[model samples]
Target: MQYLPLFVKLTDKAVLIVGGGSVALRKAGTLLSAGARLTVVAPDFATEFLQWQQQGKAELIQGYFQPALLDGKLLVIAATDNDLVNAQVYDAASARNMLVNTVDDQPKCGFIFPSIIDRSPIVIAISSFGTAPVLARRLREKLEALLPQHLGPLAELVGRFRDNVKAKITGFAARRQFWETVFNSDVVRDVQANRLPQAEQKLTALLAEPQSLAGEVYIVGTGPGDPELLTLKALQLMQQADVVVYDYLVSPEIMELVRRDAERLCVGKKAGAHSVAQQDTNQLLIDLALSGKKVCRLKGGDPFIFGRGGEEIQALLPHNIAFQVVPGVTAAAGCAAYAGIPLTHRDYAQSVQFVTGHCRPDGSEPDWHSMSRTNQTLVIYMGLMKAAHIQQQLISAGRSSAVPVAIIENGTRREQRIITGTLSQLADLVTQHDVSSPALLVIGEVVSLQQDLHWFGQRAQAAVFAQPLTHIA
Candidate 1:
């Protein structure tokens, strides 16, 4: 914090630009955007400066800049080509204790222009204290990409409702919470989507409320491996999450999408190790929601599958807590898609089944006969340890040894790997490939289509069939 940041109200304020070159023109443009009453003092004026002067948009004094020229201006800028003249201008402004900027000269200036991302009411200013302009500009570019263009409109909406919100909610905490809810609600989202009438309707409903609404929990599925696979509702829930309890399997990229200010609690449970028990996690959500905090129980895959979402939901049900579930691209689907193996195909497979490899300690396998039928795909989750047993059981149940099997490791991740082989040799292939945990095993005739359908693996290769690539931004 080399300099205290501030947004000066320059409207109707007198500002002087003591040069008529490109540098001076840039400063004049910035001041005009700020609604400053600008005066350009120079011996000679540029063509654009003369045009502005003729239009009376700005006043131009066709004379050399002197110390006396700095008399009563609210702000001044010395952007002249002459270094000596800029030094004199700096001295004159310093004597009068006025705010002045000497272009490119930090030591002689009262203020420096920041590399700003202008969203008007939602302006973001980045500065390197005149140390690195290029770095500051690069940082501004990154911020520009992260911030939505409709933020300006969103800010204007807030400005319009501020007074009403203050008058409607009496308690400080309640008032603060009201605004938080408004920001996280569908009102702002609808506005961003260019649905103004819908946004206004939502605002009206909020205004009609007699009291602040109660907070609730959202069970969000952060899709396996890829952040982009998240649902729009899931993204919104994450943005509004006051506290997020995440599992170890949630990728860092997905977690980064969460609000930076939100509290993140690691309650991940490994195969045999538990950091926070299931009961404790359920209790945490209940406590947070009761305290009026938006809680998000972020899981790796779809909550209803192998995830313990049912138990958590049951716990909340007893406590009368309100919660919503946001579905994600489950690991089975993600691995299958990224590996170029469809779970179902008309000629080879007609149905798809998802099953966990681990059964209860009673040592009974889950209906192996039904699972080994032809024209069906079997996706085994957390089944790396029992690959040999699973393969033998399926064979014993009359399934062909020639059935295609594909193991996808870290599917959808940058380091994702896929190994394809026959069902009889899948255990040996898995051993040779050293497939790790967090992998999915897909067994069906669909695996044979990998050679032609493996689009994800060939992203770097040029296509023989020409098609225009769409730029996301």
Candidate 2:
């Protein structure tokens, strides 16, 4: 709070810079863009400054420091390389009660340039008071990625409708509410999709007929177990949700990211333990949406990939409830990558297959013969319970019992564990290590690369099962 933040109108206002190097050139660019009348004083100037002079965008005075140069200027910058000269400019400006900034010198600066996020009409300025300039810049970068590019155009559209909305809407609360609805409605989507005409029409219709509180369902994939792996759209929907229906597969770290005030409903499912049935969960989503709540059905891994997201959305379809599906990095891909096991390698593996251990009554069982092929990787999700059967079937189907295998537990998480061995001891390894749910089984020549490529977290000692090959089941 050393300096109060303000957005000043510098259009056509006089400004002075006391340098001719790259730093000065950078400051000049910002000032010129703001329509400031720039006058730079330095004995020698860069070539770009001379170009600006020829274009009449800047006045370059070829002389040393003089107090007379500060006259009639709205703002001053001491950007010179010489400390004594910059101090002279600062003293002169301060003595005349004018604002001054001495570049890279915090104490001497009366005003400082903040890291800017320019969404044009919607500009955001972040400053660390010059103490942590790099940190402030890094924060700006993160904000830039999070802030959508459509914001500037969206702001412009809202401004155009401001007067009309004010005239039509009765009270302050009502007007604010209407604006909120407009922002959340298809107008923003239309703007993002570059359908400006449709967006305008939507806004007009919204004003013509007062908007009702509608509901939406966001079927979001939390991405394996790593919270950072969530898609931007998934994170957005999670925060906006009034209700989050999550399962046990979602990690605690990821669950911490949900909106603080959002209501949490656990319809979690684990092997042999179903907290809420599939049909009941579908009915629950329908009831919640029918009551006009923004529901985020949080799932682990890609919702469409064995997450039963299709069933839930299909149920919503008949009821005409609006919904969106956001895909995430499924366990097969995420687990393999973090464990440093490439699913496909021309020298080792040429193809990959993803399968789930648990299947519904109507679901087809995995084709063990095709899965037992050489020079390919097979990733099994929720297969810990049937590891014995898997090992026996694959071995009986002519696959080598000595083939390298990896059981990745809690993949991509901080406590992620990987146990490697040959296919002969798949069940024994699981029992010995007590591998829990949410683990992935990777069986292939690529798994041999784990000892060479495992990069994240700690890994257990590689056990190449000394016991002779025997089908447990």
Candidate 3:
């Protein structure tokens, strides 16, 4: 590590800044916010600095660089453009054993200001040791969006009750567990909703009871291949989980958002491939929660859709395990939007239906007659294996062989591929493109709209409809 990160309190502390330009003004604003008693030394001053001096926020000294200026200062910043003057300030501060920072000059800096995300009582400081400041700032921007805005107020509220909690809760473990419950409960919800009085009341009520550990399951739907599609509640529960039970369909980018230290157990299922049996996955969730572990049953797309989430949650019912279901952007919706093929357009199609091509254990087939209805969009999930069967069945059920169709592979992701053709050529299109699982099959007149409305994926493949079925292998 090039530098030891620290957060120092500068409230009412003496600090010196040796410049009057925009960069110096920027540093001055931050110091003032920290309540630092500042003295600035420069031959000339900016308008803002003169105004700040008049307001008694800082003391302005009109003079050249001097070693004596470092006297009795806690920290110093040399924001001057002149290299010689910046070096002079650094030497003077170094001789006096004071912390000094030379803006934009790493080797000369005894301390470097970091890109900070301030949530008042909560603050995050990020630095790259001046090697990649821009990268560090960009990272800070991303974090700023991810972190909730009410964190500071929440922290302050908890801080006020620290003494009371410490007095009531004997062991450190007990207090930590208590706080975790508070964070996971309606207390946090109330706080986030800005209902402070209700939040405080709930916190007090919670503290009045004995601290105990109870585990629950969060059935989160990590939307179709896009991490950004995850709901706020889903992300919150994911981070709070002690263990995450995921599947093959869930995107890796979505998995990365789960709690870093949380144990991950994959029960990934695909066509003809099961990493772990569905029954065993149910038992695993029950076992973990029974042992007082918070389990997150994460699934790709909407759990209630074609994801078979109902069967998993039903198993938990007998055990009386608590669970939450967070819905996600299902594959049909995600893929259609990304591909710019409206599932239900007023002119193209009035109705839309979602179905899975995987045959049932009982061998009963979906009503092909209804699914083959005209002017209706039909979206098939996991249809790659049965593409030929679907094409044959739809045509046999009075659906037109010339009906437009599209196979969207890895929909909504950067590697997404869209293959468009007629229903007669659905099987051929899949074979030619070597389409894989987790692909959505759109069959209807709406698929024809891809020619004019296709927005994402490789546009070079946009001319897919022009290719004749016989042209493909």
Q: Which portions of model 2 show Cα errors greater than 4 Å?
A: 1-137, 141-181, 184-205, 359-365, 455-473
State which candidate, 1 or 3, has the greater lDDT.
Answer: 3
- The ten-residue window of minimal lDDT in model 3 covers 464-473
What residue pairs clash in candidate 1, if any at all? none
Give per-residue CA lDDT, model 3, range 1-473, as digits (tens): 99999999999999999998888999999999999999999989899999998999999999877888888899999999999999999998998888999999999888999999999899999999998999999999999999999998899999999999999987654576688878989988888999999999999999999766677898988878877778999999998888999998898888889888889999979877987988899899999988777899999899999887899899999999999999999999988877878999999899999999999889999899999999999999999999999999999999999999988887777567778889999998988888888789999998887777654333423343322121111
RMSD of each: 7.7, 9.2, 6.4
Candidate with better lDDT, 1 vs 2 = 2
Candidate 2, lDDT over the whole model: 0.88
> Which digits, one per residue and each the tens of the lDDT, describe model 1 over residues 271-384?
556789888998888888888778888998788888888888888887788899888889998767766677899998999999888876597778889999899999998888
